[model samples]
Target: MQMGIVRRSVGALLAVIVLLGAVPVGAAEKSAPRHSAQAIGKAERAMQEITAQAARETATAEMQDTRISSVMLHWTPYPAAVRYAVRVLRGSVGAPMKTIATMEYVYTTGLHLPLMAYGAVDDLYWTVQPLGYDGTPLAAASEPCPVREAEADPAAPALTTEYAAMPYAPLYPVYSWVPLAGQKEHEVEVYRREVGHDRYVHTLRGGEYDVYDDTPFTVPGTYVYRVRGVTAAGMPISNWSAYGSFTVAERTPIAALGDSITHGGGAITVPPSYQLYDWESYCTVPVKNLGRSGDTTEAMLERFERDVLPFAPRVLIIMGGVNDYRVGIYGAETVRNLAALREKCRAHGITPIFLTATPIRPALMTARMTINTPPSDWWAHRDYVNNWVMQQEHSIDVATVLSDADGELEEGYTTDGLHPDLTGKKYIGQTVDSYLRTHFAYASAEAERRVRMLKNMEKTS
Candidate 1:
């Protein structure tokens, strides 16, 4: 029985060997494929190459996204351009480009856009077409401007305030600067020019890019100012900017006091630093801009003692109430504020000239400023305030030219629908200019009479 079992095991082993092509274990190991050291190294290097290429591609994509987000297109303000048409094109230079994004109504010379808004494109360019009030092309489309990558870090803040010598210097000067990115606040230092040196008078800190110095410049003297950016931790983030100098004197001829409209700057992204956006820029007369960016009628009235008192302007053009009305403040409240402002002007011997508030288009306002939600009764409030203004002895109905048939701000005259752009501002400024020119001799005579009265009183004393 044992012999028979042994024969069966041997037969089974022979059958397995036959199934394995009858190869021996040692022979099978030798016949198997073997890789050379050189070959193995080459395979590993290829994998490293593939990984590096992937990392480079990811870095390029991230850089492109950063560039797209920071894209801001700026152009020279075209003459007679009520508005501009901006088109973003995608293609290589000298290649047939396709317009990917077109903004039909850009009110200012600058336009900020997220290039990613139109999807991924290897090459992008922009062009501007100046448009007339009637939507006619005022000039041919500008040559395509390449969308270059923006700088990683913008330069330090630079002062933008206009300086003048004593006797012509503004008493209530608006201190303004080009704000730095990531700035938590701005530090403004005022120094009075004293005995062959500048004496540090005061230092003020605020979050706003522009400051209406409420501290009255009562003394007529030379003053120097500088600004720097600060971090939230109270640490200085930038070096002191180049000094700005102005001389302070008494009695400004004419000044404008209002909200952002009179403060200058329109078109959502542009700041008041750009002169073209300022209505005062279009005026023939040199009107000092006392208009703060976000002042309501109440705020304007409150600041009168501090801001308007120092200037002692011969004529103060008052345009406000839109900030109050948009937020649903009662028209009566705004009117009361305006009345208070008028009374204060009279008390200080300053002539107060009212400007009818411009109408607003809620749809456009929402599109431009999502945070803004003008009340449903906003127009009613505006009408109430404007009606009161019309009854004032010294008033100009600027709203008449800015409002459409439906009483909304005319699209051609505005970019944000709330603040009037270049065209509307031009109309407002020119109207005021014409009015002032017409009554120039009368105003001059009144000013002279006041001067004579003051001199006589001084002589008697």
Candidate 2:
């Protein structure tokens, strides 16, 4: 009996050893395969080679923000490859000059872990300096590099993550819409701002959703949220989606009052011209953008009774001070100018909604580089008037407030800091919409009338 038991135990041990030996040696040893060491090293080196090739191919694609230009590259997609077409202009395109370099990448789907193939390239890598046509060295071009490989399996167990996307508009609150279909077992986290703090406000399990929507968040400020999807295999994809920011603003009527930003500046249809008032169409109430380019706040104040009062607008939106601040008006004087305009609106039983001044931009910065500071202290003056405006909110019934303190200036927002470019004006319209949704009672017919008026004004404008 003893011999039989020992023999059975030995047989079991031998079976286990054979099973372990059958697995791939490299997989078990946690190391590279010996026979293919040379080949693997070559592949690793090829990554750097491709990066170097990319630099040479895209030499002319490099540029700077100083020239008031944009980088427009063509995206041509094939089965598994993409090519970039480049066009760079230092000055006039009077004659077709030889482009600096063109770049492209090739991808394959076959065997042996497909590689980043390349096309023809120019020697654009500046580390090995090359002289230009005139023997003058052109600016050295920066080089591209390869992304590193992960040490561990991305789908490994024990990792957990979350992601979220929220839309934020300064001075206006927003309600988000999130869909839950395939993400049944994942954990969802929502971060919201109250007063000025962002704390974890809501959490839902995988099987449950729809617990967050149209849910009011904090006042006006930047809020971030995240959600994490976890698979049964314990893999986590917690990448946070882009931040969706929407400001919280008091609702007010669409005030049609101003100049160039209103009248549409330039020739009948050029940027920085009168076309800026196209946003009146998006307003909740009728707005007659009686703005004229080169019009000052004082000038606007002078004509408020004649131009704005006749419309019987429930709310008067006013965005000026760019011209005032540009001409050296600061602090209290700015307040007085804005206050006088507000008073005129109040006298005519119209509510005044103030659009806070946007920040001074870098391009505009150079013109005043010698002034110690930009001519427009709109940043400071705006705060002063806003403080006063907040106080008067009770006295004159100013309902909505629109501001751009948080929105980053992209090409569309402002060509310069003071004026709203085409897209910037439209963004202002969105901001105004958010403000009206919050502070006013839209259910009222009076409110509906205001909406109709805004629609007509938008059509005419």
lDDT of model 2, residue 305? 63
Task: Assess each prediction's global lDDT (C-alpha) against the native.
Answer: 0.72, 0.41
Measured with C-alpha atoms, the lDDT of residue 446 in candidate 1 is 50
Candidate 2 Cα errors over 4 Å, as ranges: 1-254, 265-277, 365-373, 376-378, 394-412, 441-461
User: What tens digits encode model 1's per-residue C-alpha lDDT throughout 60-106?
Assistant: 66665465443545566665566789888989888899998888776
Which 10-residue window in model 2 sums to the lowest lDDT? 106-115
Q: Per-residue alpha-carbon lDDT of model 2 for 1-461, expressed as tens digits?
A: 33444455456555555654576866745654563465445545654555454454344333221121111111111111111222221222244334333321111110011111221222111111222212333234222211112111121111111111111121111122121223334554556555557677565444212122323332323355444555665365444333433222223234455555554421111222112234554454434445555567787787766555544567667766555655666657767877998777778777777765443454543442333344434456645654665565632211122234442234234433444444555566666666766665452246556445434533453
Question: Could you estimate the TM-score for every candidate?
Answer: 0.59, 0.36
RMSD of 1: 16.8
lDDT, model 1, position 261: 90
